[model samples]
Target chain A: MRFSVLGVGTSFVESAMAETHGFADCDMNSQLLSPRLRRRMSSATRLALTAGERACADANVDVSSVPSVFASIAGEIKVTDTLCRNIAGRDFPLSPTQFHNSVHNTAAGYWSMVTKNKHAAQALGAGENTWVMGLLESCCQLRSLTDKVLLICYEEAAPEPLVMGEQISDCAVAMLLGIPSDKKRSVCIYQQRVEHAGASTELWSPVSAALALAKAVRHPQNSSKLPISSTAHGWYAEVVHGE
Target chain B: MKQLSQSIPITAYSAVTACGLGNTPLYMALESGKNCLQPLELFHIDIPTCVGEVREVLPEISESLRRFDTRNARLALATLNCEKGSVRHAVMHAIEQYGADRIGVVIGTSTSGMYETELAYEYFRDKQHMPESFDFLNQHAWGATADYLKYELGLSGPAYAISTACSSSSKAIASAQRLIASGVCDAVLAGGVDSLCRLTLYGFSSLELLSEKPCTPLDKNRQGINLGEGGALLLLEKPDSQHADRPHLLGCGESSDAYHMTAPHPDGLGAQQAMHIALTQAGLSTKEIDYVNLHATGTVMNDASEMKAIKAIFQSGVKCSGTKGITGHTLGAAGAIESIISLLALECGMMPGTAGLTEADTAFQYDVMGASETTASVRTVMSNNFGFGGNNASLIFGQYADNG
Candidate 1:
């Protein structure tokens, strides 16, 4: 199956040159959300919303009209840690807002509320393969629904206890994908099942996968295949840049 | 775009909830209008709230799968082990027909083994050292349930976890249908599982959304939701000539509220749109629906908003009920669990009443059943599940008639 990349948005390391890649610095102040809604959002939700807004803006599409698939490896880890800490301390009363925001779909929910987008939204988690799985889900939806799909993959660093030893970065990536209405699309993504051992990259988290896919979309190198995960016979993408 | 609705056959399904161990108990509870809510016993919390805890002893995992052992996984395993492991039987048959690589697994969960994470945190808090056996991937990851199911079933198709709050499992079913429609897989094991943890109880309590008594949806005196724990699984495959008798998943409609994170749209716009989409996709009108399984969480806002949506969709007399009074709100697993209930309603020709409902809220015009009834010849039924972040989903299941 093939799909066209219509727009791309990336939120890299805080100090990195994210604006150069069409992403603004991760800003918590979102004009898309009301002040009340903005105050309740976590860092992860802010990152996802920022990237999603940028993607929609880049594509010049109404965010509310396009269906979205949000993928994350560890969802709202800081909130999870907060709840864990409260429970560990035998704190009888945990903050209700924090608890509700601790769900894996918190970011996705915030996206919908902020955008006022009532379209179908899905929140997915697949460990380190979240981005690829999310891509697969989006492509399937696009094929079945025959509509544009906004795909967002994001992750953030957690506190100490949940962090363990794995080094995680705060980042988010968004892409507007669809069947090209016009032939002038810059890149067409072809999905193929390949032997998982053909080529692989060491990915610490789902954010790396999103960054790699964003890189491919940005550069549009011809005849390039990116392994989505380390699974032996998983699905990989073959990028064909259009002239 | 008007696309043909993919009629996926639910070959096998199972659920383990607070009502009992298997679908049989769940069906019986629904039939008898049983309320399974009980005072908190499994763990201690200072709040005075009731819960729908699974009283049945969960099966112990084998040594190899011990790393994945957790309350949530155990509840999921218990559901799969129901009816002499009917889900496994269906999976094995699908494997024989389609090969393991062609059958995928998609599990929906909100808090996968979060209880284990809470325990690990408690241990660390006291010992100042993380436990040696603490594996985040196996226990705390949101994909842990899917991973555990995949490993246990030995299938290799496109497996992942959906975590769209309460709509997780409902979307999982929709995703499975999409996977089949996209020709990505021949068959998919799709469902949801969520085991109760202190975080959820305290979380709901913190939100003041937990009812001190058993939840009473659509009742004038309703307070809040009574949290529950359960797991439900369904084996979905393309409708073939041989399985025409099986219940068919007619259509799925999903929408985001875009209203609020914790609260629903005041006017139930998203909820109505979701139900509308489901009815449109199913090629049915409001008159064709025999029953509606409401997503009423017993909270004042949820019930009121859902009533508005129901009023906007169906006619004055369309029968509706909320099963949370019987099973409590199962959170992420609710979509699949309630879908199973809707399937049972279609198959058994019985519509479960809204248990614990003393008096219907007079503000709504819809008919909210307060007692179970066996007179309805249920053919097509819709199950509604709305989650946090204003995520809403509605699934329509139709009773299959063998034309052959």
Candidate 2:
């Protein structure tokens, strides 16, 4: 029911900025991916890797040694829309790169390829009670399977039809989680209630919920039943000092 | 294997595929050695190939759940409504046995309703906007179908979707197991629903991986894959003495090739690790495995890599076969459909054969079945599904026997 958060990393962009230049603000300067690799990826994936790499550095863990769970709401929607446009236009040849990168697990696959980690990586909706689901996913792996897991929640700024005709902040958050231990300084995350944010349009919202949890992990306070949601989606969790 | 996952009971299951509606037709086709794949008729394709299309006329989503109307959702409904509503009755029973709030739903899909979305995009290209009838959140968005199942079933527990391409549903099963294993939910409706779409067809075609003829896995003259579509659902519950007669999902293992975006590892190291982990979690050795549902997509590279992995895991005599010959490649739903096929094999004591295979590749250390149906006293079966992005998942199911 509880797991330790060893480190957290986040990347956030203003809604207005994300709307105008979703890719211009992308900071792909991380040391984990090469420049060639950076150019080949979508901005959403770059943000995910940037946050995941930073979380690994913050946790002082080798990225190659850990498994991961990459969550997203409208994963690869941009690329998918493009491919659909190509197909509708009667374009004969679909780009193989875009087709392969169009999967929801694109970020997870990229993370593993960069690190050469054979550890199991999972990709889920990563939304709808979005990051809470991500946290629960991490804790489940910790409880039943892996010792350490990298949990990354990221979403691209959805295009017009997919969103509510408004821009949401572009953000990606990553947390390194492990089984709670007295030997390590960590924050204990316990699920208070599972939420289904099914009907909410917050899929395009900023990663504010994930950011709140990361910020809570930083607070030197023992709080139970902390409310975190980007919208009216009801979900609650608690974080306590593990050290 | 750091830990042995509890063998969760599969209380109920149903599937809709090319053969027909429900597991009965699927099993009948497997038993009669029938190839259900036929020439594509659901949609037009420039490429000449056969696909395992669900020939049954799909039901319309009720006006109340019209927002969920899509080929994918309809396929799920067909499966749920199949066999005079066994899976539906099981869900209702589970809700009464355990609180509705204690049940969860997790479905997998490579594409929820990309077919509809692709049509919408065509309108947008011409009209500059989508039709008012299209609701991406309920129809085409990620996790939409899982959410549809949750709301349709009136359950309030955790629900989501896994979208790791081909391994989506198997991973969904693993997540369902985790929900039970982690004490989060008493039961979960876990499986996958994928419909044939132009994107996947064109995508794989552009890669030159589409076999013009029927896909013949493990055949010396194997070409490529014939894409298929279907939905399969399994009700996984916490271990119960009451349901001990049902088959148990022994264990699951997932790994990444970390080798290529689309291609698998040449030596099948990741595939081997996944099989090893699944067996370790099942607390069984290779000798105990009665059959393996190979993830052979009828591609030369895929079969070659998976064969190496098979060689590394099982000895020469272990029975194995690829069902893509009969069903074509179902993409996301392949995992759950094949798992159900394995469960059927255990129940009927009939091992499926390679439907379109003429000759098995002789370079392997394992036994790959041909057109001849092989029946044996099968106890435990393993199914493998490896997807793009190097995602690989293996699941083991065995007949529940307390004495063993």
Candidate 3:
């Protein structure tokens, strides 16, 4: 049984960067989100939520009924820093509110809470193929019960000094999937288990899989593609074949 | 989906914990009724404590996998000696042996690399400078663990990390089964690991959830839960003619009560839904269950809610116990660890006791096993794990043959 990719939305570095790539300009500074939610939300979450919402809209999905798989390479790195600071000092007093939001599942939790989705919801993260894994998980969820699964993948450029020369850019991408009813802009995903006998490098996060995916969605001519990312144990490579 | 009328098999497994470096030691400890819990000495905890810490400090990997500099990464790297390419090798071997391309990995963890993130904050603030050696790549979020694992294992099929508090790992297993049954994957790696961190300890302490002494689950004088660290992995594959000896996953059920954030529903509505889901998914009546691994965390609210949930579903006289008293609650890792205990009970025919269970609460009528082992003819076993925000999951495993 083959599943069809429905719609994809991505929020990347400012519009200036997109302009260079001949991509449509999406207002990065647009105030589409509530101030309070935006205030508390890390850039990763805000971008992720926005991208997911746009993709859901593109897929013509009722966000309330769909099961969502929100994937991130690092969830709320800022909160982790806050907690660490509190713990390292004398009289370590953790912020009860921040502590609750710090749960890696918080993004999905907020999605469910905000959308009032009683359906199954999950938050997933993998270092390398965050996008590929998110898609697989989404496909699996749809195969199990739901007809459609929303997969949101995102990563924020680590602040000031996060090694890797902090060259990592902030971006979020969301894709909605279902049995292909619409043919236009649709891509098919097939599962392959192969040994990754490739050169390894110091990559930032597996969310790069999402970047590769966005590229695929934008450029269908490159149907047969292979995107690989590193893990703590080895490497996971996603090979897309066929139109 | 309804419970599989046939059995599912566990073809391979890997584990890293204080109980031992691998699964054999863990099984032996459970069989001999050994408690891995000891005085806490791994990290800085002001309170007196008991923990299930790995006896040996795992060495650094010679050829490091990723540049994410975090304590959680260190722990993950330390635990990474599972025969290079064991995971992907197992998947390919399974495909060759069973003829299936659907394979996945479901991991669980509460705090991914928060320990390292925390350290980064201090370094940035104190010195007003970022360390040249500090690589913040993988330490930014909890998904890194799952991300790193997928890449490390070369699993491009399907993977996700479940972070439902203490039940995280257990939920991962449930998801893996669902994926397998739905044909999303032919096999899956399901388990969990959580390294101890000051953020977790201080957070729990602030909420008065950590026990000042060794945790005593189900005891009248029970205090609270002891935070722990570790990981466990179970390779799940669909049943085939050649793999007749594998244990079967019968059913899995999940629910959320929408109750208080840190506390459970007073009436156990979510817990009941989860238990009923498990039984219903398995297509078996409550009477068929041989034993229950309860989510008895020793917190007054948690214990009370679990008791209420259990009594609400099971008929009187069904035997159930919490193994947390022995291993302490490993938080997100608890579900995976307890799952091991449940399988061990089925395989070894010996039920590990509720080590710290003493005075039985008279409010509930179920049979609560005291601090001792029992050998019984077990056919089906159930394990429960609940997390913050009323997230709960229950899994049922049957004898290999009866599973089908």
Model 3 over residues A1-243: C-alpha lDDT tens digits? 346667777676577754543445533331345777677776666777777777777778766767677777666666655666566554466777678767776666656555655445666766555666666666666665567778888776664544334334576777787754554455555534345445345564555566566667667666454453444323333223334
Q: Score residue A176 of candidate 3 by CA lDDT.
A: 82
Q: C-alpha displacement of A209 in model 2, angstroms?
A: 0.5
TM-score, chain A, candidate 3: 0.80
Residue B311, candidate 1: Cα error in Å is 1.1
TM-score of every candidate:
0.95, 0.94, 0.82
True-contact fraction in model 2 equals 0.66
Against the true two-chain complex, what DockQ does each candidate achieve?
Answer: 0.72, 0.65, 0.33
* C-alpha RMSD over true interface residues, each candidate: 1.3, 1.4, 3.0
Q: For candidate 3, give the lDDT of residue A148.
A: 77
Residue B395 shift from truth in candidate 1, angstroms: 0.4
lDDT of 3 by residue, B142-181 (tens): 5656556655654545666778777788889977887777
Over A1-243, each residue of candidate 2 has an lDDT whose tens digit, in order, gives 567788777655453543343323434456788889988888778878888988898899998999898888778777887898898898978998999989899988988899998988888883455566677777788889989999988877777766634534467888899898765545544434445544554343436566666767777474445554434445565676654
Model 1 Cα lDDT, one tens digit per residue, A1-243: 677888877655464546554445644445587777667777788778877887888788888889899898788989998889889998768888888889998888878876778798899987756777888788788877757999988887777776634544577888898875545343333335554343223334667656667777777653377766654546566566566
lDDT of 1 at B57: 88
lDDT of 1 by residue, B261-302 (tens): 888888899999999988887888898889999998999999
